[model samples]
Target: MWHIYQFPLCPFSRKVRLLMAEKGIAYELQSARPWEGEDRFFAMNPAGCTPVIKDPDRNIVLSDSRAICEYFEETVDRNPQISGTAQQRAEIRRLVAMFDENFFRDVSGPLLHERMKKRLVLRQSPDAKALREAMKLAHDYLDYVDWLIDNRPWLAGSTMSLADLTAAAQISVADYLGGIDWTTHEQARAWYLVMKSRPSFQPLLSERMEVIQPPSHYAEVDA
Candidate 1:
């Protein structure tokens, strides 16, 4: 059996979980809090990150979402998320990087730090200024998604890929944090609704992170 060490709301972990579910890979969740700095967790992964996957039978221990995803991509022949021609694969990676790095930096990371980390981990009040900044940047990111939806079926190109999973993971977290405002983003909202309606997304929507809760619309597929 494969076991994944991850937190409920970690977007990168969510990305891996989505990919695993979409690809029909079986894995059990082993909840972890990297921020807590547990000795066992650090011993398993020196970097101390969530989304670590271990296969005891195979003696395989993998950390880092990208590395884990790519490992499965190479090992599994079916349900290729990074499929198609060389150019198409490149496009997928490009968009994946854009969401994983830029979007996280500008939106999801800040919201997580303010709304989740501050409240749960730090036991401190969220800074209104930082919260406002994250929400404002979320609009910008969603605006870009709206434009992308206008141009392509998915973020990268025609078929669903890692790009979709990555963006959906980030957006789901941001939306959960109430950092997203989909009121004016019709196209983006429609795109995300499709994502939310997927079978792989259902578990994520239903799961909670301790005391904090998402907005009512967060789990509603039609919303």
Candidate 2:
């Protein structure tokens, strides 16, 4: 069986988990906290990140959400997340990059680092300045998401792709931290409602950390 080492609220981990669930692939979920920098985990992934998968059957170990998702996209054909023509696939990749890199750097990454990881895992005081900067940047990021879904059916194009999964993963984590203002971004909220309603996303919504409780509306897509 495939085994994926992940943190319950990690966006990168959620991305891979959502993609696997969407494809109807079954795997064992091995929880890990990369921040501890354990020796065993380091042997698996020197970079010390969650969302690393070990495929015993295939004799392969994979790290990095993008690389893992692309590997699955190529090997598993049951449900293609990157489906479409060449140009459409390119667009999907572009948006996925935006969420995983740009949006992450400017918004979710800092927020999660300050509000969630610092308090819960690192046992350090939250950085107020970083949190404030993240909150402000998140507004602009959500506005862009709102604009993207204004016309298109999905973030990248007509169909759901890695872009949507990546986006929802990041946004869901932020929402869990009470960082999102859903009422202010109507289109983005609508899009997220659909994403949240999917069976693939149900598990993520149900996840709760012992150290931190999510907001009341965290699991409510309708809210």
Candidate 3:
């Protein structure tokens, strides 16, 4: 059995979920919120990050989200291939790393830590400066995305890969939080619209937060 410890809102967790769905893999989903400080979770992963996977057969515990995705790509042979050629695989890894490092820090981090922090923690006020900075960073990131999509059909290359999934997960969360302005980035927005319509993407669209509601357009796959 494959068991995944994850937080629903985490982009990293979302990427694994998407990959699982795309591969038609049936895994057990265990909600493990690192923010709540679970001892066993920390023992499994010292970093206490979400999206930790335990494979019973291998008796292996996978901590990092990217590592888990790569593990799946290598170990599983079902569905559309995510890691294509050597060059394609390298590009996917590069793009995934880029999204995880630069995009997450610049776009998703501040938006979640600032604008949505108050929602998650009552009595806290939104950080206007952080939100402004995140918005600027998101815009800058979109420019890079524009360049990517303009050149290639997908973020890494012609074929859809984990790179697209990683980027989509981040953008989807930002969209849920109303941190993205679609009109400003038409190319990226159009690419996202197509991704949001996929069967693997539906679960994420239907995700509802107890304390926060997504914009109407969020659930609209065509949007």
Candidate 4:
């Protein structure tokens, strides 16, 4: 069996998990918290990141989530067209990059590091300045998503792709922490509702932190 080294809450890890579930691939989940500095974790991934995949053959040690997703797409039998044709693949890559870069940097990263600090049980107090900055950045990011959803059902295009999963994973974390104000971005909110309703998304919605409870409508598909 393939062994997936992951933390339940990490967005990147969540993306890989979602893909695995979508493809109906059975794998063993090895819980590893990179923040704790495990030697084995470091051995698997020098960067000490979560979501590393260890193939049973021990020949392939995949680190990056995108690379792992691509690997699975190429090697697996079901739904092997995650990237589609060369042109479509390029677009998927671009949107996946956007989610990892722009969305994570300007939205989820700050929300977790700032607004959700209290819930995450950090040693430091919530930084008001950082919270304000993150809120502004998140709102702007949502505005862009709003525009995208207005034009297309998915972030990259019509069909559900890795791009949607990547963005959904990050946004789901924020939503879990109650960091989003969905009322402000109706289009984005609607799109998210659809994604959140998927069976693949159920695991994320049910995920609970020690101190954090998801919003009341989190488990509601039509909410």
- Winner by TM-score: 1
Give per-residue lDDT, candidate 4, residue 41. 88
Better of 1 and 4 by lDDT: 1
Give the lowest summed-lDDT range of ten residues in model 3: 114-123
Q: After superposition, how far is residue 42 of candidate 4 from its true place, in Å?
A: 0.5
lDDT of each: 0.91, 0.88, 0.83, 0.79
Instruction: Give lDDT tens digits, candidate 3, residues 115-166.
Output: 5656675458877788878777888878888889999998988878888899
Please tell me which predicted candidate would have the highest lDDT against the true structure: 1
TM-score of 2: 0.95
> Arrange candidates by lDDT, highest first: which order?
1, 2, 3, 4
Models 1 onward score TM values of 0.97, 0.95, 0.92, 0.90
Q: Output the lDDT of residue 113, model 1.
A: 96
Task: Give per-model CA RMSD.
Answer: 0.9, 1.3, 1.8, 2.1
In model 3, residue pairs whose N, Cα or C atoms come closer than 3 Å (at least 3 residues apart or on different chains), thus clashing, are: none
Two-way TM-score contest, 1 vs 2, winner: 1
- Candidate 2 C-alpha error for residue 29, in Å: 0.9
Evaluated against the true structure, the overall lDDT of model 3 is: 0.83
